[model samples]
Target: MPATRALVLAAAVICLAAAGWLVLREATDPGLAAHPVPGMGEMNAAELSRDGYLVIPAMLREVYVAFGATEEAVIHDTLAAVAAGPALETLYLDRAGAMAGGGLDGADQEIHEMELLDLASSRDGAMLSVNATWRVLGTVGHAEHMHVRGNVYSAALTLAPTAAGWRITGFELLDVDRSDAGTMVAAPEPAEATGG
Candidate 1:
């Protein structure tokens, strides 16, 4: 009976240790603590703060909406409104032009979910990373009609305070996972990759 009691005590200790390890892992995960952007909700720019959590996500959403638009004027206006510095030039000159030239101008995309993965900020500048899932519901680059429900992208962005407000200065797309019919497809090889 004493041996049986010892075995039970050991089992309980192991279970407790496992539970403690899980708790610690969760506590240390940055994604678990990051803020989730409300889907398709309007964020008041006046309420945005440099040190607060809302600014990065809001600006990212604006960029997303602008890229999804079919009208060049809308894309130009939205990017101009929300971005400045290098980000503005890159988006307008490089990315938007690429989209039009690649036949992505007619595609319709919308971000259905977004998660802030990390953030760091100072008095004058800020940097953040985010993961967003967009629903793609139109043809892409002259391909047949496609509907991708889980097109996930990871991006890093930088922002600075300007007289007009917080303006995004940098944007880099890090990774992409394009989906087909709601199923996650394998990421393409580096040479074949096209990012958002």
Candidate 2:
């Protein structure tokens, strides 16, 4: 009778050991690459530090909108500028990965490159001495009448974090130097010199 009891106890121990191994494997799997972004249910500023850079693509869109590149990039008889808007929107939405599913035109659409270097609280962050550079150029549909190319542009701005998320509290965009932020001008042909 004692031998029977011992055999049952040993089987139970083996089962528990196997379950533990499976849990450890899932937690330590590096190649699988899980839990990149934390969602609302996942955590807040406490467990994960709200001061972290919750890099949402929408914030980047807000900056783009503030710059108003849509009108500048497009020219008469050209489609490049018009297409860039939707394409830019697509790029930002993908940053959230598959878990985010898709992005809508709301608070989620206003986030961009949010590299939170400091976290004052789980609900707030500050970036007074922040440097940021973003460049995006994409073709619009299929058009041969124009080209979409420009020099790199950089700027510095101070961003702040709030309950809604990170925001540009204050910023100064110095000389663009040489940027093709659209605003292309057409060239004129010279008049006949014989009459002169």
Candidate 3:
């Protein structure tokens, strides 16, 4: 009976220690510590401030995919929804408007990988530098189809606080590495340049 009690106590102590370890891990985890509440649309500024590392990458992916949309409405609306201020103007003037004669009619973009390289935050806003590996597939224009894969680029972005959420306020493309076989390479451009 005494041995049985000792065994039960040991088991209980082990379980408690495991639970405590899990709690400690979660508390220290940057991703989980700042994780925002999951919802239907974009996370707002407050949420972004809490967890820019997690939110910004996903947002960029959405913007990249939206750029490939053939419909002008989709292009404009998607950009407008994700960006504001200088960033929005850049997207309209440089990216969406710069489409070749036919635009990205059948173009599709895929982000193979994205990493948050750096982040700087202030009371009013934040900045991020990101590196991504992406590819574009399908016909972007007559004789201008894109088939690049493993293309890489780095982008610098500025975010400002807004009532809706943290909106992209500025964007700049820092560098690019095109694939050797790239035909019509498409890169992720800033303001110049996502998620629901």
Candidate 4:
């Protein structure tokens, strides 16, 4: 009976040591540093912040250059892809305007370049701010002939974290005409000028 008692005490001590080791590991390991909230799963605040910075710009570029018969399809697709919040929808309508019957038929745009200038996030990782630039060639509305214009624009987007992930909450943009600075090169001349 004494030998059996000793064996049980040894097993208990071993179990206690294992539990302590696991606790120490969770305390020290960076991977386990962020304690996930209930229902939040494995994603932590830092991961959410990084993903927010990375994904929002790419999605914005996609929405920007995505042209179709009407703005409806593009708008719907963009909203679906990003799952932007209501505040962002207002900004989208203001910036893209095509949703409000601003696009011409047969109009299409090509994004020549895109760059992320800056990215930042809130302390709680609930919000992210992003600055980016894009170079694009798009049709300019004219009754008789199609006119392709190349332009550069800068944008700032704010993101909010939601159960579905990061979503755009706000946006702003500044457009500059490339032809004015004589920097736009290798682009076809306006069809109206060529009478084509």
lDDT of each: 0.57, 0.36, 0.57, 0.55
Question: Candidate 2: where is the Cα deviation over 4 Å?
Answer: 1-58, 65-125, 138-147, 177-196
Assess the local accuracy of residue 145 in candidate 1 as a C-alpha lDDT between 0 and 100: 36
Best candidate, TM-score:
3
Query: For candidate 2, lDDT tens digit of each residue in 52-151?
Result: 3343223444444433222323221122211124333443333324214432222221222233222232223222334445455532111112233443
Clashing pairs in 3: 44-165, 44-166, 45-165, 45-166, 59-194, 62-194, 190-193
lDDT of 4 by residue, 1-196 (tens): 9999999999999999999998997666543344322233434445655564456456666566444335566656656455467645764555467545544555444444455545555533345566656555555443444445566667666655555555566666655547632232343466845889
Models 1 onward score TM values of: 0.51, 0.31, 0.53, 0.53
54 Cα displacement, candidate 3 (Å):
1.2
TM-score of 3: 0.53
Better of 3 and 4 by TM-score: 3
Count of clashes in candidate 3: 7
Q: Model 3 segments beyond 4 Å from truth?
A: 1-50, 101-104, 108-146, 179-196
Q: How many clashes in each structure?
A: 0, 12, 7, 0
Tens-digit lDDT string for candidate 1 (136-156): 332232343334364555555
In terms of lDDT, the best-performing candidate is 3
Which pairs clash in the backbone of model 4? none
lDDT of 3 by residue, 6-124 (tens): 99999999999999998887566432232222232544344555565666666666676667676777877777666778887887666556566435555555544555555554333
User: Model 1 TM-score?
Assistant: 0.51
